[model samples]
Target: MTKVAVISANGRVGSLVVKELVERGYDVTGFGRKAQNTTVAQTYIQKDLFELTKADLAEFEVVVDAFGTFAPETLHLHVEVIKHLTALLAGTKTRLLIVGGAGSLYDDPEHKTQLVDTPDFPAEFYALAKAQTDALTELRKHDDVDWTFISPAADFQVDGKRTGKYILAGEELTLNDRGESIISYADYALAMADEIQNGDHIKERISVVGK
Candidate 1:
């Protein structure tokens, strides 16, 4: 069985991801924002990430940083947390899977990545998402054991078939005829857990879209 840790595993999307991982028989740990009623994971931590020690990263084989949503305040926290995590997991042979913002997906064929090129995506949020995207991109250059930064679709709408069926591709956005990119949270979690079970698409920053 694969042993995995999901940081920020108690939120809406994170919680679902944790459940899916646990159901897959992975030794899963769910990091919660604060101590709460718990039973979803093999082990549960109440403290936020600021309290995470290298010892925490040492506990699992793969760590998925999923502790955030689309909050602008989280951009700095995302970079700060990832830098801290990369350092903590360094030289340990432990894998890292980063979940990133979709703003980086471009809607227009002629534009810069939709998030980076758009003048008006979300004024308060774009910069931070862009920063996180850059952080994930830079991580790929490291000669590490295993690292993946998986970006979701431009339309990562919460409601959709949870079927794990989806498309995985490189730097370009996978768009349908309607011109919207979409992937369910279920599929996202499935892909993450599948990677933990048996690694694939390694050391790459890619995007996922449902058919």
Candidate 2:
């Protein structure tokens, strides 16, 4: 069985990822800031992510960081948490997958990625999202962990059931005729899990959406 460890078990996306993995028969372990909904997991470690030490990361093959939300105020903590987690997972074969945002991707041929250089986006959110993208860049210094930064569709959020369908894109962006990119939350979880099992887009940044 693939020994998988997921941080942020309490978060909406994290819980769904863990639940899906468990149902798929992987050895699922969850590290969460809360105490609820973890009984379904193989093992639960109740600890805040920043409080997690290098010793705590031992023996897990896959570590997915799904810890933050779209809320603007939590951006610094999100970036710092990823920095610390990558540092802790350094010097090992353990894989690191940081949950990224669509703000860093190209939404139109004539425009830059939505969040990086856009003036209309919220200032605090823009700064922090930019920082998160930068954190992924700085992580290349660690070379030990196999890292992947996954940016979801602007509206491809979690909070629903699995749809088992999504489209994987190779840049150029995927959008509907109406000029929008969207994927259900469950499909996003499926993509994250599928990447773990398939290893299709390792050491790269990719985006996903539903058909």
Candidate 3:
């Protein structure tokens, strides 16, 4: 019964991750603004993300930060929360797993530039994408905490179902046979749960896409 806590558990990706963990028989808890999906969690906490302290999370062996926002004004908080969590869990055994965006993924094998740096990248998602990229940067600076950042495919499917099949890749973006970088939220959760159980990518960044 490994203990796990999922923040932002009400969101699309977060909820699916909670479901995956729960079905895997992990002792799971969910924290969010709303407590709609109580069945997926052994226990649910309704609290603001920032209001949660390290003490509140001390019970879990792993904490998954699934927090996300599309608004430009609050994008900086993405990195802020990372800094806060790193500082709080600096000397503890609790591991941090971040659900990162695909913007930071490399456009090529050389790893010269991220997808966000490409010329054709959409302007509307620039701020949010860069913020997620910066969050990964912040995680890299810390040597005291054990953390793993998992990025989704460039084209993440919100309504996609769980096929329980996905391809995992390193820092570079992953593509399918048709050359599409996409993954369903349900399948993404499968990859995430696998990482939690295996701990194979500790202190590293990885990505997943549909096979």
Candidate 4:
């Protein structure tokens, strides 16, 4: 079985990723700052995410970074954590798969404007969005690390159900036939699991939306 570690495994998206990976027969482990009442992973590790070193993660074949933050003060941790992971996994065989944000995706066909720069972008999430954008920028600088950053659609619905269908795209934002950029956390998790099994987008950034 493929060994995988999911950081921040107690979070909404993280938990579902854990569930999906486990159901797919992967040897999964959940890492968090604290233990939760329930988790789908066969093993759980309680430790600060930053404190995790190469030695701690050397056993896993893949690491899924599902860490997220909305607080203005801590938003920069998004980039810092990605840097930390890449630095640790550099020259190693393990793959790092990041659960990224759509804010950095180009909103126009010309590839000129990002969704975060649009006038209709939510003011409340600007800081978080920018932080995630910076994280992607930082991840791009690492050439030795095997990494894949997967961004969700503009509408990342936490309460949305699994449709078992989605469309993947490149840097530009993608829309369904109905002209909407939306994806449920469940479907996003499904896509993540597929990527983990297939390893098709190594060292690339991709986006996904519901079909």
Any residue pairs clashing in model 3, and if so which?
none
Task: Rank all candidate structures by their lDDT, best first, as comma-separated numbers.
Answer: 4, 3, 2, 1
Residue by residue across 73-151, what tens digits does model 1's lDDT show?
5566766777777777777778988887776666667645566566767666667667776676557556654787788
TM-score of each: 0.85, 0.85, 0.96, 0.97
Of models 1 and 4, which has the larger lDDT?
4
Q: Residue 64 error for model 3, in Å?
A: 0.5
Candidate ranking under TM-score, highest first, comes to 4, 3, 2, 1
lDDT of 3 by residue, 45-114 (tens): 9987788887988988999999998877889999998998898788888999999999999999899999
Ten contiguous residues with the weakest lDDT in model 2: 110-119
* Residue 182 lDDT in candidate 2: 86
Q: Rate the local accuracy (lDDT) of all candidates.
A: 0.74, 0.76, 0.91, 0.94
| Error of model 3, residue 85, in angstroms | 1.2
Candidate 2's residue-wise lDDT over 88-157, tens digit each?
9878888888777776776577645545566666665566668666666676566677888777776755
Which model is ahead, 1 or 3, in terms of lDDT?
Answer: 3
Best by TM-score: 4
Q: Of models 1 and 2, which has the larger TM-score?
A: 2
lDDT of 4 by residue, 1-211 (tens): 9999999999999999999999999999999998662578999999889999999999999999999988778898999999899989999999999999999999888989999999999998888889999999999999899999999999999999999999989999999999999999999999999999999999999999999
What residue pairs are clashing in model 4?
none
Q: Which candidate is the best by lDDT?
A: 4
